[model samples]
Target chain A: MMPVEAFLRQDAEAVRPAPALVKRGWRKLLFGDVASSLLTVLISLCALWAVPRVLDWAVFDAVWRGNGQACFDAGACWAFLGAKWPLILFGIYPPDQQWRPIVVVLAFLAITLWSLPERNWTRATATGWLVVIVSSLLLMGGDTLGLQPVPTGDWGGLPITILLTVLSLTIGFPFGILLALGRRSEDRMMRWLSVGFIEIVRGLPLLTMLFIAAILLPLMLPDGVTFDNLSRALVALTFYSAAYLAEVIRGGLQSLPKGQEEAARALGLGRLATLRFIILPQAIHAVIPPLTNTVVVVVKNTSLVLVVGLFDLLSAGRSALTDPDWPSPYIETYILVGFVYFVICFGISRYSLWLEHKLSAGVQR
Target chain B: MARPSPARESTASASTGWRIAQVAIVLSLVGLFAWLASNTAQNLHSRGIMVGFDFLWRGARFPIAESLLPYDPTDSFGWAFVVGLGNTLYITLLVIVLSTALGVVVGVARRSSHPFASGLSAVFVDTCRNMPIVVQLLFWYAVVAFGLPDTDHASHPLPGVWFTDRGLYFPRLHLDGPLLPGVFVLVVGLGWAWTVRRRDQRRRTETGRSPHAGRKIVAGTLVAAVLVAATTGLRPSLEYATLGRFNYMGGVTLTPEFVAILVGLTVYSTAFAAEIIRGGLDAVPRGQWEAARAIGLSEHQTLRLIVLPQAMRLIIPPMTSQYINIMKNSTLALVVGYPELNFITATTINQTGQALEGVGILMAIFLAISLGASWLMNLYNQKLGLVTR
Candidate 1:
C-alpha cells in the first residue's frame, strides 16, 4: 500500500488540471485543423477590418452636440437625433401634450411586464390589459377628459406602432382560437370555411392587405360610412394577425393526443366547457412561445402602415429626415429608428425564450 | 400518402341544437358578405367610379421609372402590370438564390465547433433578425442613396465595377451575330451532358462503379458552345462604362432602390432561413455522424453522403415556409419605391380610381403564387419523406 500522503498527493494532481484543459480548448477552437486555423485567421482579419471603423463612426468621431452645420464632416450626426427626437417619438402631437403619448407608452409597458409571470397570467391580468388600453386611448382621444383633443391623425410614432400591435393581437387572439377550432371541427362546412378564410388572408402579403384597407375599404363600405386610416389599418391587421396566429395555434392543438378531448368528454364535460376548461388552456400554453414570435412579426409589420400614409414610427423617422435644416443625416436617423425597433422586437423574443423554458420544464416536445 | 392529422373528432354525433348553431353561423357569414358586396356597389355607384377591367386597356400615363422589360409611358395598363410582374419575379428569384447561399453558410457556421465562427454567426443572426425588415429596407435605401459617393467621385471596388450613389455600373456583355442558333446548339449540348450525369449516377448506384463520362461531356459541351459562338461571330463583347455629361453611361446600372431592396431582403431573410437550417441540422442525430466516421468516411464525405440527406427531410418543410415568406416580403420593395406588384397596384388605383379591381387582382395573383408554390413543395416533400406504410 502507498503511504497516505503519497496517495493524497496523487489524487490532488489528477483532480483538476483547469489551466491545461482550458489551454487545450483554446487550441482546438483556434487551430484544431487546417480549415479551423484558416477560419480563425480570416475571422480575426475581418474583425480587424470592420470593428474599429464601426466604433469610430458610432462613437469616436461622432458629434455629440450641435446643429446641422457642425455635422458636415462628422462620422455620425448624433446631434441630429437630439434636435429631432421629439418629432420622431411624438410625430406632431401637440408640443405641450407630448407627455400623453409617453404615458400611453408607459401604460403599454406596465401591462406587458405585469402579465409576464406565469402565476400572474390570469383573467385579472387580461382585464388589467383592457383597462390600460381603454385608459390609454381615452388619454390620447382627450375630448372627453377635459384635456386637449388629439386627432387620430396626430396619433403618430411609437404609440401608434405599440398600440396597433397590442390591439390587433388582443382582438385577434379569440378570433384566432375560434378559427383554429373551426378548422378542426367535425362540421365539414365550418372546417372548409375556416380553411378558406385563413388561406386567402395568408396568401396575400401584408402590404396588399393594407392597400385593401386604405384604398378599397372605403369603396367596399356604405356611402355614408367612413373610417379613418388608423381604424382601417387596425381592421386589416386584425384579420391578418388572426389568420397567422390560427395556424400557429393549430400546431399546438395538433400536438395534443386525442385522448385529451376524449378524456374530457368521458369526464362528462360539455363541448364548449371542455374546450374552455381543458383544451384551450393547455393548447394556448403549449403555443405561447410561437404566439409571441407571431406577435413580434406583427410588431415589425406595423411599420408597413407607413406605406398607407399612416404616421407610424418609421414614417415619423422619414418625416424627420425631410427637415432641410438638418444636414441630411439619413443614416443616423435610420439607425436610431432601427435601434428602437430592435429593442422592442428583441425584448419580446427574449421573453418568449424565457417563457418557453419556464413552461416546458421537464416536458418533452 | 400524406399523414392525416388526428383531428380528434367529436366523440358523439352533434345534438340538433349544435347542428342548428353551425348552420346559423354559416348562413350569417354568407349574409354578412352579401351585405358588404351590396354596400360596395352602392358606394362605387355613388362615387361614380367605374369598377371594371376596362381601365386596363387605357394608356398608363404615369412613369414607372424602372422596369425589367422595355416600357413606355404610353403603354397600356395591362402591359404595365405585366412589366411590374416581371420585375417582381426577377427580384424574387435573385433573392431566393442569394439568401439560400448566405443562409446556408451562416447556418452551418452557427453549428461550428470553432468558437469564433459560431459566436460571429450568432451575433449576425440576432442583430439582423431583431430589426424589422421594413426599417432595414429603408436603412439600406439610405445607405445606397446617401452613403455611396456620387458619380463624380465613384469608387472602383473591383475591375469593371463602379459604385456610386446614382447606381452600380458594371461592364455589359453583348453577344454579336445570330444569338438564337448559337443558343439552340448550346442548349442541345447541355441537355446531352445532363443525361450523361444521370447515367453516371445510375451506374454508380447500381454497380458500385461510376464510369464518370459526365464530367467529360460537360467539358465538351461547354467547349463546343464556345467554339460555336466563335465560328458564328457570336463572341461576347464587354462594354465598359464611361463618364458621360452628368453620370456614368454605357454600362448596366443597378438602381439604388433595387440594390437596397435586394440587399435588405437577402440579409433579413437569411437570418430566418439560417435559424430554420440550424434547427434542421441540429435535429439530425449525432449517432449518424459518428457512424459515418466509424465506417472510415472522411468528414466531407460524411457530410455530403450521410448527414445532409437526413437533415434535408427536416429542413425542406420549414424552408418552404421561409421561401414563401421571402416572396411575400419582397413586396416590402414598395417602401424603397421599387416598382413591384403592390407598387404597380397602388399606382394603378391612384391613376384609374379602380382600387377594388386593382387590389382584387393583386390578391388573386398572390394567392395563386402562394398556393402553387406550396403545392409543388408538398409534392417534393413527399418524395423526400418516409414511404407510405
Candidate 2:
C-alpha cells in the first residue's frame, strides 16, 4: 500500500539518531544560556528538595503488607489496601455474590476495548453491547436465573460507576441526536424547544441537577409513585449528558458540508433517508474524538455521586475506611482511588488523541 | 455566509407528514408537562407543604463560617443566600485570575526550548488533568487538616506565614479611615497607569525603541499605594498572626476547607486552560517566528508583537468556556463544607422542607450567572474574532 518515496521517508525517520541528540539535549538544557542555566539550577534544587521527601513518604517508608498495626506509624499504609480491596471494589454488594460484579466489570471492559477502534464497530458490536448491558443489569440486580435478588440500595464501587456512565450514555445519545437535528431543522417550534432544553441544562452544574434528583424528585412525584435514588440520579445524568452531547453533535452536524444533504435531496431521497444514509455516518465519524472526551468527563464526574450519599468508587473507598483496624490511611485510599480514576480517564484521553490523529491523517491524504 | 442552497419544494404528502410530525412532538411534550405538573401539585398537597418563598424571610438560625460581607446567626435565609453567593463569587473570581496566570506560565513552560522545563510541565499537566477534582479536594483537605502539624507545632514557612492544622495564616495590613476617598483615588491611579502603559506601548511600536515601561508601572503602583495609605491612616502599619494560648489570634486565615477547594480548583483548572493556551501558541505557524527573527526582533518583542496577538484569536473562545467552568466548579466547595450556593441550598431544603423552592433558587442563580457571563464573553469574542475573506 505504501509508495517507495514514502517508505524511504519512514525509514529515514526511524533511522534518526536519538542517543546523541539526548546527550546534546542535556547539555543544551543545563547550559544553553545564562538564563537557562540559572533556571536549570533552580529547578534541579527544587526537585532535589521535593522528590526525596515525596519518595520517602510514598515508597521508602511505606508498609506493603501485613495487618494494620505495622501501618500505624508508617508513612503510607498500603497494606490497608489489601485488607479493604473487596469492600472498596465491590462495595456492600453481598460477599458471596461478588463474582457477579467481577464478571460484569470484565465484560464491560472487554467490549469497550473491542469497540474502541472505529474499524471494529459493526452491527455485531452493537448487538453484543446490548446483550452485555442486559446481562450486566440482570447480573447486578439478580432475582433471575436462580440468582438471589439484590437491592439497589447496596450498589457501589466500580460497577455503579460503570453502570451510571453506560446507562446515561445509552439513554442520552439518541435524545441528543434528536435535539441536534431539531435545533437545525426548519421548524420554529422544534428549534425553540431544543434550544431551551440544551441551554437550561448546560447552564447549571451537575451537582445541582443531582441535588434535584436526590432531594426534589421524590417530592415532585405523585403519591405512592417512586424510584430509587440511583434511578433518580440516572435521570439527572441522562438529561445533563443529553444536553452536552447535543452541542457536540451539533458541532459535527455543522461541520458536515451542506452539499452532502443537497446532493441526497437531488437524488430524490427523502429527508429522513438523507439523514440516515448520507449525513449521520460522516458526522458521527467527524466528532468521534470529542465524544470520547465527553466520556472522560463523565467518568470523572461520576465521583460526585458521593455528594448524594451514593456509593460510587470514591464513596466506596471512604466507607472502607470505617474499619476499626485501619486508623487513618485516608491519603493512601485516596491515592489508590484517584489512581484508578486517573488510569481510566488517561486511557480514554489517549485513545481520543490516537483517534484524532488517525482521522486527521485520512483527511490530509 | 448564507446557506449553500435551498431545498427543493416539498410534495403535498411530504408537507402533510411534516405537519403531523410537528403535531405529534408538540402534543407529547405538552402532555408530559401536564402530567408532571399535576403530580407535583398532588404530592405537595398531600404532604402538607407550603410551597412558596415565605420561608426565605425567616431567620436562617445558622452560622456561615466565613463571608466577604458581615453576617450573623440572626440573619434571614435570604441574607444567608446572599452571603453564600458572595463567597461563591469571591472564590470564583480569585480562582479565575490566579489560574489564568498559572495557566500562562505552565503553557509557556510546555513550549520552552529547554527539554527539562517542557518535560516537567507535561508531567504536571498530565497528573493534574487525570485525577478527579473531588479526590484532589479531599486529599488537600486531609493534608492541611491532618497531615500537617497542629497549631502547637505549626511550620513558619515565611516570617509571618504559618502552616497549621487549623489553617494557613499570613500577615495582613489593616487600614482604617475614609475608605471611599482612598478607593476613588486608587481607581484614578489605576487609570493613570493604564494610559501610561498604552501610550508607552504605542511609542515603542511606532519607533522600535525600548522603553522602561515595567519600571514605570512599578513606580506608579508604589506611588498609588502610598497615596492610598496616606489618604486612609497616614501611618504605615503591620499586623501579624501570633501564637495565642489555644490558636492563632490575628492576621488573615484561610481555613482548611477554603484552602483545599481553592488549591484543588486552581491547579485542576490551570492544567486544562494551560493546554488550551499551549495549543493556541503551537498553532501559530513556524514561519511567523522565523519571519520575526529575520526582521531583527528579539524573542520577547516577537512574542509580544506577533505571535501572541494571533494566538489570542484562538485563545479567547476556549478561555471563555474555561472561565465559565470555574464559575460552575466553584459549587464543588459544598463537598468540603465551604458554604457556597449548593451548600446553602442543601441547608435551606433541610430547614424549610421545601426542596422545590431551594433548588429552584439555586438553578435560577446559576442560570443567570452562566448565561450572563457567556453573553459578556461573546461580546469580547466578537470584537477579537477573525474576519474571513
Candidate 3:
C-alpha cells in the first residue's frame, strides 16, 4: 500500500502536460504591442489620406503625355523619364552604335552568371578579364571592332558606372594581394614601402583623390600626355580600392594559423612557392566576406565620379530630373537610382553569405 | 694550419654577404631618390612654379562658411587650416561618443530575451548595413533641408522652441560669470566619490558586509556638486530664441548641415557598432554568468561585477576601431558642404594651386588621427586584458 503523499505525487506526475500557446508573462507584452501597432496604423492612415488627396490633384487628374506647360502638375511628371531613359542610359554614344554598350552589358551579365558556378570559376577569372579588356576597348574606343570611334567624353550613364567598377576591381585586387604580401614580408624595405603606400592611399577620401586627379594631375602631366577623364577616375578608384583591399587581405593573412606557414616551410618550399601554393589560397578563402564588403563599398563609391562631372548613374538620374519638361521628378528618379544600387549590393551580399556557408561546411568536423 | 672559431667564421661569411647586399640596396635607394627629386624639380621649373612653405604664412584671400576659431578671408592659410582641423576633431569626437552609446544599446538589445527587441535590431542592422551610405546621406540631407517645414511656418510655438528647415531654435544657457569654479568643484566631487567607493569596497572585503558602495558614491557626488553650485554664486539665465524681423535671435542655433551630418553618421555607424557589441556579448562564456548566479549574487550584480568586466576586453578593440571608422567617414560631410577638414582642404587646394601639399597634409592629418586613436585605445585594451589574465 502507498502513502497518501506518494499517491498525490504520483497523480501530479501522471498527467501529460498541455503545451501553452502563450507564455506566463506574455499578456502585458502582447497588449502593449497591440496598442502601439494600432497607433502606428492610425498615424499611417492619416498620412496616406493626405498623400492621395495631393496625388489626385497632381497625378490622377493631371496630363499623362504632354510637352511644356501641358505636363506641369504637382505630382511626378514621369513622361519625361520615359522620353529620356534611352539617352540617360546610353548617354551620347552615337545612336547607330548604341549596340556596343548593349553587347558589352550582355557579355558582362553572361560572364558574371557563368562564373558563379565553381567549375567555370577558374576560366572565368582569366577569360573574364580578357573579355572585359576586349569589350571595353570596343565600347570605349570603337576603332578596334570596326565600329565608329567614340571618345570617352561621350561615355556616360549606367555603362560608365559598370565599366569603372569592373576596371577598378580587375586592376586593383591583384595589386592589393601583392601589397598585402609585401607588407607582411620580413624584408624591411619592401614592408616599409608597402606599408607607406597603403597608409597614404587609405588615409585620403576617394573624392579628394578623384578631385586631385581630375584638376591637378592634368597640370602635372605635359600636354599630349593627358589621360582621359574616365581613365583618371579609373586610376583613382583602383588605387583607393587596392589600399582597402590590401587591408582586408591582411586580415585574412593574420587569421591563418602559424602552423600553415611552418608546414609549408617544412615541405622545403621557398618563400614565393609557399605563398603561391599554400598560403594565399587559404588566406583568400578566409577573407571572402570582407572582400565582398570591399567590392560593395567600391561599387557605391563609383558614384563619387559624379563630383568630377562624369555622367555615372547618379549623375544620369540627376540629368533626368533636370529636363525642363519634368522639373519635379527628382524624387522619383532618385528612388529609381536608389533601387538599382540596392539590388546590386543586396545580390552581392546574399551570394557571399551563400559562399560562406558552402566553404564552412567541413570545418566543423 | 690555422683554424677559426665557428662564431667568427659564420660572422665573417654573413658580414661579407651583408655588406654586398647593403651596398647594392643603398645604391639603388640613392639612385631612385635622385631621379625622383630631379624630375620633380625639373617639372616645377618647366611650369614656372616655385615650391616652398611661404604660401602657408602668407595672407589668404578666401571666404570660409564656418570656422571654429576667429578667421576672415584675409587670414593666413595656416590659420584657416588650423580652424578646419579643429572643426574636424570636434565632429569626430562628438560622433564617436554618440554612436558608441547608441551602438551598445542596440547590440545589447539584439541579444535580448524578448523577441520584439531582437527583431527590431535585426531590421535596423539589415536596412542600414546594406544601403549605400552616399544615398542615405543625400536622402537625409534632402529630407532635412528641402522636405522639412519651411522657415516661415516654423515660427509657430511648439513647447517653447521653433523647429524649421533653417534649424532647431531653442533657449540657450546664458552665464553672467565664469562657470569654471563650479566645473572644478564637480570634478573634485567625482574624484572623491571614486576614492570613497574604492575604500568602502576594500573595507567590505575585509569585514564581510554588503558594501552598497555605488549608492554611497552617487549620493556623495550629487550632494557635493549641488551644494558647491549653490554656494558658488554662478549667475545662470535662459536666452530663448526670439522671432525677429529678419532672423531668429538669442539662441544657440544648430545649422541644418550639422544636423544632417550628425544624423547620417550616427545611423550608419550604429548599425556596425551593434554587430560588434553583439559579437562581444556572445564571446563571453555562459559559464561565467552561471557561476556568478551560483554564488547567490543578484542578476544586476552578476551583470555589472562579472559579465561586463569580463566582456570589456573583447568589446573595446572593435568599439575603438568603429570609432576610428566613424572619424574617417566624417569626411563624407564634404558632400553636403559641412566645412570639415576635407572641405577646407579642398577649398585650400583650389585657391593655392598646391595640390600636392594640400593632399599630403590632409592624408597626414587623417593618418595621425587614426594612429592616435589606436594607440590610446590600446592602453585601455591592455588594462582590460590584464583583468582576465
Candidate 4:
C-alpha cells in the first residue's frame, strides 16, 4: 500500500547498510589493501605454528597425576604441583595447624575484595582494615581462643607473603604521607630530615635493606631486645616502601593547585585542618593509580624475603622442589608460582586502569 | 591598612614559639643520632666486630667465578669490588642497548596496522610486566640456561657460537692491523660529511631549494672510510672457539649466570620501555602525521624525521628512569651467583663481619651511581626539551 517514492526510499536504505564489522576487520587484518596484509598473514602463520605447541605442552600433554615415571613424556609435569600443593601453600607451619594459615589467607583475600568496591570514603573502612589486621595477627600468632601458639618464625608460604605486603602498605602509607608533608614543610629542618631519609632509603636496593635488617639491626638494638626474622623483615619492608610511597605522595602534592590551600585558608581552616579535610583528600584521589602500582610492587618484592631465609611463597616452592621425589620438576613448580604472582599483579593493574578511567570520567564532568 | 596593635604582639609570640619548636625538633633529632651512634658503638664493642674501611686493604681470598677485570683470590677487597663493579656496568650497558632496541621495535609493532603483530606484542608486554622479575630470572636460569645441553654436546647455533649449560661461547673479533690510522680516517670523513651537510642545510634554507647533497656526502664519506680501511689493512679476524674435554676455549665465554641475568633484565625492562615508547608515540598529534603526508613525505620519512623527534622529548625522561631501574636490578645477579655489587658486599659482610662498613660501601656506591645517572639524563632531557618562545 506504500507510495512509489516511499518504496524507493526504503529500498535505498536497505541497500545502504555498510558491511558488518567482522567483514571489514577481516579485510583490514588479512587482505589489507597492501604489504601490511602480508605481514599480518606471516605473523598469523607463526602464531598458528606456536600456539598449538604451547597449548599441547601446557594442557593436552600435561601430566596431571602419577609418579615421575608417568611424566616422562615431553610435556609439563603438573603432577608435581598436585602432590606438593600443601607444602607450597603452608611451608613449614605444622601439618596439624595448616588450617590456621588457610583461614588467615582467606581473611586477607576477603578484606582485599571488600575494599575493591567504590563508595564514599568512610571511617568504617579504616576500622574494617584494622579489624582484619588484628584478626590476622591473632590467628597467625595464635595462643588465644584455645588455638595453639605459633611463633612468627614458623609462619611462611602465601599467608606470610600476603601479610607482609598488607602490613607494610597499611603501616607505611601513613608514614609515607607524613614524610611527604615533612618534605614539603616550611620548616627547613623537617624538610632536610625527610629528604635525607627518603634519598638514603631509595638509593639502596631492598636486598641491602633486608641484609641490614637481618644482620645489622640486631647489633643496633639494646641487648635482650631481639626481633624475630619476620619482624625484622617487616620493619625493613615498611621503611623501604615508605620512602618510595613518599615520592609518589610528593608527586600527588605537587600536582595540586595552589588555589586549594588558599581557599581552605580563606575559610578559616588551620593548616592541619586544611590538609586533612581538603588537600589530602584530593591529592590521594589523584594518585590512586600510582598507589595501586606501588601495592603491586610491594607484593612482587615480597619474594625477596627468600634472601633473608624467610619461607615466603617463592621460597616455599623452592623448598618443595628440594624433595627428592620432585627433583627435576622445578620448571613446573616455578610456572605454578609465577602464575599465582601474575594473577595478583595483573588483577591489581587491571583495577588501576579501570580506576584511572572512572576517575578521568569524573573529572570530565 | 589599620595600625598594628596587640594582635601583632601575639603573632610575634606565635612566630617565636614556632621557632622554639623547630629548634627543639632539631635537637631531638641530633640526640636520636647520638644515641644510635653510642648504641652501635657499644654493640660493636660487645660483639668484637671491627668497623672500618681498613678491610678494603685486606686480601679477598675468595675467587670470583666471572670477572670483567683481572682478579685473583689474592686480590684486595678493593680490587674485588672494582671487578664486581665492572661486571655490573658491563651487563647494565649491554641490557640498556638491547632493551632499547627491542622496545622500539615492539613499540612500533604495537602500533602497526597489522593486528597480529600488535596483538602479539601486547601479549608479550602483559605477560612479562605482570610476572615477578625474580621468578622470571629464576626461570631463565633454571629452565633456559641450565636446561641447555652439557658442554660435551653443546648446540652449535651458528658456525662458531656454542650453546651449553655452562654458558654461551661466541667468536670474539680481534683487530688485526693498526687501528689508529683507520680511526683517524673515519673521524676526518665524519667531519667532512658534517661540514657538507651543514652547508647544504644553509643553502636549502636560504634558497628555498632542496640540494639533497647530504645523502651524497654521507655515501662519499662511507666510501672514503672503506678505502682508507682497506689501504691500512685494518681488518678484524674472528677468534673462534675450540672444543675441549671440559669446555670451549679461545672465544668469548658468557657464563650461564651472566646470560640469565642479561636475558632476564632485557626481557623485563623491554616490556616497560615498550610501554613508555608507546606512550611517547601516542602523545604525538595525529595532525602532525597527516601534515607530513600532505607535504609529500613518505610514511617512513615522516616517522623518522617528524614523529620520532617529538616522541623523544616525551620518552627520554621515563626512559632515564627505566635505565636507573635496570642498573638497580643488576643487583639481582646475586640470586644466580653472578657476583655483582650486592653479592660482593654480602660476601664481604659475611666474611669480615663488618656489616656496617659493607652496607655503607654498598649504599654509597649506589647513591653515587643513581645521582650521576640522573644528572646525565637531566642534561640530555634539557637538550631535547621543547624550546618555548
Candidate 5:
C-alpha cells in the first residue's frame, strides 16, 4: 500500500533538511509546536503582568510598618489588614486568650483533613469526628476545659464560618436523610408530613429562616430556655441546609430502580433493612457528585452570615475595607477573599468529578 | 381454599410485626412533636412573645421602595404583604423572560458549527457557572457598579437610553389605544393557527403528501394579526426617556438590583441549559438527519421536522426544572434589593415583628408558584410521553 511519495515523505519527516529557512521534515513539525508554545507563553506573560504590579503594591511599595499615616501611598496598605487581622479573625474575643482560637483552628483543620480521605470512611471515623467535635467545643466554647470562658459572640471570622458550615452539615445530613426517607415512605400520613416539611422549608428563602431564628426562636422557647445568637444561627443554618440536602437525597433515592427494592424484599429483607443495606448504598453512590455540589453551595452560602451580622470571611473583608487607614484596598481584600472561596469550591468540584468518574467507570454500558 | 388458613396465619404474624413497627414510629413522631410544641410554648411564655396572626392587621411603619400597589407606611402588615407579592411577581416575570431567552440562545450556540461561537459558549459556561452566584453578584455590584461613573456624571450615549449608577434607563413604549386588544388578537391568532394545523394534518393524512402545516399556520396567524391590528387602530410609539438634573423621565428605569440579579441568573443558568440542549441534540442519531434530507427536506426542515420533536421529549423534564429554578433563584433578587418575596419577607419581619407569619406567607407563595408550574408541565409531559407497551 505504500506509495513512493509516502516512503520518501516518511524519511523526510524523520530528519531535517539542510536549509534552515525552508524548515523541512521534523524541524517544521517541531517549529509549529514550538510556535504554539511560545504564543501561549507570551499570552500568559501578558495576562500575568498585573501580578508583579500587585506584588509591588502589596509588598515592595507597601506600608508594612504603619498604623495610620505612613500608609498614605498609591500602593496597597496591607498594614491596615495586618493591624486588624486578629480582630477580624477572632472578632472581639478577649486579647489575652487569642492563642486558644489559633490552637483550635489548627486542630479543626488537622481533623478535617484527616477525615476527608475515603479510606477513613469507617465507624472509627465517626468516633474520631465526635472526639474532634468535643475537642473543638472545649477549645472554642471554653469555660469547662480549664480555659477562660469565651462567649459565642466573641467567635468570628473563618473559624465561625467553617464551624457553621461543618456543624450544619454534620447535623443536617442525618436529619435530611430521615426526611428524604419519610417523603418516600409508603405510609401516606408520614409521606405527606415529610413532603409538607420539605416543601415548606424549601419554599422560604434562607434569610427569612435566619430572621426567624434570630428574632422568634427564643420567643418560641420556654421562659428560662434561651438560645445564644450563635446557636440561633446554627439552628437556622441546619434547617436551611437540611431542606436542600433532603432534596439531594431524594434525587439519589429516586435514581434507584423499583426492582432494586423489590429484589431486596424478595430476599426476605424488611423495608428498613432493604433501604439501609441495598438501596441507600447504591443510591447514595449515584448522587455523591450532586451531594458534594450541595456541600460546596453550603460553603458559599455561609457568606450570608453577614445578613445576620456575623463576622464570616465576607463580613471580615467588608470590615477590612472600613478601616480608615486602607479604604482603597477594598478591591484587593475582596479579590483575596474571592480567591480563597474559588480555591476551596474548585477543589471540591474536582474531587466530586473524579468520584463521579470512578464510581461510574465500570457501569458504563 | 383449605391451604389458605396456614398462609393467612404466617401472613398475620408478619402483619403483626408491621403493626408494631408502625406503632413505634407513630409514637416516636408524636412524642417528638409534643416535646417541640411544649418547648416552643414555654419559650413563648418566657419571652413574653405571643405567636399569633393578630399582628398581621397592625400598621406596618416601613415603606417598600418599588411596590406595584399603592402602599403607604400606614398600611397594615397584610396590605404591605400584597405589595410585596406584586413586587415578587414583577421580578419573577422579568427574570423568567431574560433567563429563558438567554438560556435558549446559549443552548443553541453551544451546538453551533462555528469554532468561535462554540468556544465563546464554552467560556461563558465555564466562567459564569464555575463561579458562585454570590461572588458573581458581589463582583457585579462592586466592580461593575463602582467602576461606572456616578449618577451625577451619567451619560446617554444612545439615542433613547441612559446609563447611570442607578440603572439602565430606556424609552418606554406608549400605545395610542388599549394594548390588551393587541394581546387578545395575538391569542386569537394562536387559536387560528391551531385550527389550521388540525385541518392541514387531516389533509396530509388523506392525500399522503407531507403537510406544510407550519407554513400554513404561520401565514394564517400573520394575516389574522395584521387584520386585527388594522381593525383596532393600535399604533404604538416609543416615548424617549429624558434625563433631568436629578432623575430620568418618560421611561421605565431598571434598578441595579434587578440588573445584577437578571445578569447573574441568565449567565449562570444558561450554562446548564446549554449542556442540556447539547446532550439532547447529540442524542439524536445522524441517520435520522440523513434520512430527513433524503426525502428532499432542507436543513431547516430536517431540524424542525425530524430533529427537534424528538429532542424536545428528552429536553422537557430538565427544561421544566430549569424553569422552576428560575422562579426559585428569583429569591436571589433579595440580596440586590429587588423587592422580591424574600426582600418583602425581610421587611415584613422587620416591620411587624411577626417572623413566623412573614415566613409562612413567603413559603405559601413559593409553593403555589412551584406547584402551579409542575401541574401545567405534568399535563404536557403526559401528552408528549411515548405511548408504548
Candidate 6:
C-alpha cells in the first residue's frame, strides 16, 4: 500500500484555499446560528431586565428590621419576617421552649444529610435514624429530662411537618411492604383485601381522609373515650402513605422474575426467609428512585395537615399573616415559607436523580 | 411417592387446620367491625347526633361566590352539592385543556435546539413542580386580590373586559338571530367534509394516487357555512360588562378565588405534564427519527406523522394519571373559597354535624370521578395499544 503521507502531500499541494473566514468562537456563540442565536439573545435580554428588579425588591431594598415601617412600596418587608420568624418556626409554642424545636429541626437535618450518601446507608445508619427520630419526638413532646410536657397541639411549624412526614414514613414503610406482599400473594382473599384497601384509600383525596380523622373518627369512638387530633391525623397519614407506597413496592415486586423465588424455594427456603434474604433486598434496591419520589411526595403532602387546622409550616405562615402588627407583608412570609419547602423537596428530587444514575450504572456493570 | 402415601391422615388434618385458621381470622375481623359499628351507634345515640343523610334536604343558607348552575342561598344542601360538583367539573375540564396545551408547548420547547428555550422550560418545570401547591394557590390568590386595581378604577386592558380586585369580567357572546339554521348548516358542512376525506382516503388506498382534497373540503365547508349564515341573517354579538354600583352586570364574571384556583392548578399541573411529555418524546428511539429523515420528510411532517404517534402511546398512560391528579388537586380550591365539592361538603358537615354522611358523600363523588376518568383513559389507551398476532 502506498504511504498515507504521499497521498496527503499530493492533495495538500493541489490547493489550500485560504481557510474561509468562518464565524467561529464568540460570534458563533452569539449569532452564528441565526434562529437559535436570536432566541438565546432574546431570552437573555428578558432575564437581564427582570432579575435586577426582583433582586432589588427581595434584597437590596428590603426591610431587614423593626416593623417594616421603612419599607418602600416596591420592596419586600423582610423585617416582618424577622419579627414573625419565631412564630412561623415554632407556632404558639412557649418562647423559652422554642429551643427544643430548633434542636429537633437540626437533628432532622443532620440525619437527613447523613443518610444522603449511599455508602452510609448501613444497619448502623438505620439505628442512628431511629435514635434521632425517637429523641426528636421526645424533645418535641417534652415531659422527660427535666422538660415540661408540650402537648401535641402545642407542636407546630417545621418541626411538626418534619415529624409528621418522618413518623408516617417509618410506620408506613413496613406496612406498605406487607400490603405489597399481600397484593401479590397466591391466596385469593389476601389479594382482594389488599387491592380493596389500596384502591379505596387511593381513590379519595387526602383532605377528606383528614376530615374523617378529625371529625368522624372521634364520633366512632365510644362515649367518654377520645382521640387526640395529632394521633388521628398521624393515623390518616400512615394509611394514605401506605397506599401509595404499596403501589411503588408492587411495581418493584412485579419487575422481579419468578425464577428467583423458585430457586429459593427449591433450596428449601421458606416463604418469609426467601422474601427477607433473597427477594426483598433486590426488589427494594431496584425501587430506590421511586421510593425517594414517594418520600418527597409525603413531605409535600404533610402540608395538608393545615386543612385539618393543624399548625404545619404552611399553617404557621398563614397564621403569621393574621397578626395585626404585621399584616401587609404576606408576600414576604409566603416567599420565605415557599423557599423552605422548595429547598427540602428540591433536595430530595436531586438525590433521587443521583440514586437513579448510580443504580443504572450498577446495572450496566 | 411412598412418603406422600404414608401421610394421608396427617395431610387431611393439616388441611382442616388451615381451613379452621382462615375461618377464625375472617370471623374475628367481622366481629371487630360489628363491634365498631355498634359502638358508633351508641356514641351517636349518647351524643344525640343524627346518623342519617336527611339533612341534605334542608336549606343551605350560605352564599357561594361562584357557581356554574343556578343557586340561591335557600337552595337545599343536596342542590348546593350539585352546584359545587358543577363548579368542580367546570374548573377541572378547563384546567385539563389549558394545561395540556401549555404542557405540549413547553415540552417541545424543552427539546429545542436553542439553549435558552430549553433552559427556560427547565426552570419553569422545576420551580412549579417543587413548590408546595397550596403556597402557589395562596400566592396567586394574593396577587389577584391585592395586586389588581380597585373596583372603581378597574383595568380595562381590552375594550369590553375588566379586571378588578373582585374578579375579571369579559363579554359573553349572544346569538341574536337565526342561530339554529346557521348551526345546522355548519354541522352539515362538517359531515360533508368527513365524507369527502373518507372517499379520498379510499381512492388513494385503491389506486395509489389521489388528489389532496383536504383543503378543498375545508374551504367548501367554510363557504357553505358562511352562505347559510348570510342568508339566514345570523348575527352574533358580544354582551359587554357594564359597571354597576356594587358589582359588574350583563357579562360573565370570574371571581378572584376562581381565577386563582384555575390559574394555580393549570400552571402547577402543566409542569408535571411537560416533564411527562418530554420523557415520552425522549423514549422514541433516535433511529425512528433518522428513518423519517431518510425518507425525505420535513421536520414538521416527521414529528406529526411519525414521532408523535409513537410518543403518544408512551405519553397517554402517564398523562391519564396526571389528569386524575389535576381533578384531585381541584379540591384545593376550597382553600381559596371557590365553593367546590370539598368546600360544600365541609360546610355541610360543620352545619349539620353529620360528618359521617358528609364525608361519605365526598368520598363517593371523588371515587366516581376518579373511576370515570380512569375508565375513559383506559379505553383510549386500548385503542392506541399495539395489536399483535
Q: DockQ: which is higher, 4 or 6?
A: 6
- How well does candidate 5 score on lDDT at residue B148? 48
B324-367: candidate 1 lDDT, tens digit per residue: 88889999898899999888888888888887888878988899
Per DockQ, the best of the predicted structures is: 1
Model 4, B197-266: lDDT tens digits are: 8998998889988776767777777787777877888887899999887788888998888888999999
TM-score-superior candidate, 2 or 3: 2
Output the worst ten-in-a-row residue range by lDDT, candidate 4 chain B.
Answer: B5-14
What local lDDT score does residue B82 receive in model 6, on the 0 to 100 scale?
Answer: 95
Query: Model 6 in CAPRI terms: which quality?
Result: medium
User: What ranges in model 1 sit over 4 Å off?
Assistant: A1-24, A362-365, B1-13, B177-196, B206-211, B220-234
Q: Individual DockQ of the candidates?
A: 0.62, 0.57, 0.26, 0.49, 0.21, 0.51
Q: How far out, in Å, is residue B131 in model 1?
A: 1.2
Per-residue lDDT over B1-389 for candidate 5, one digit per residue giving the tens place of the 0 to 100 score:
35543233342355777778778988998987787678767665664667788887888888677766888988888787788778767766776676667766777767754443466677677666655565566666654465445677777778887778777788988778656666777787788778877888888889977667667667777777767776788787898777677877668887767677767776677777777877888889999999999989998999898998888888888888777776766666676677766777787776555666676777677778777777788899898897889
A141-230 per-residue lDDT for model 3 (tens digits): 787767788888887777887888888988999989989987997657668978988977775667767876876556556455778889
Docking class of 2: medium
Question: Clashing residue pairs, candidate 4?
Answer: none
DockQ: the better of candidates 1 and 5: 1
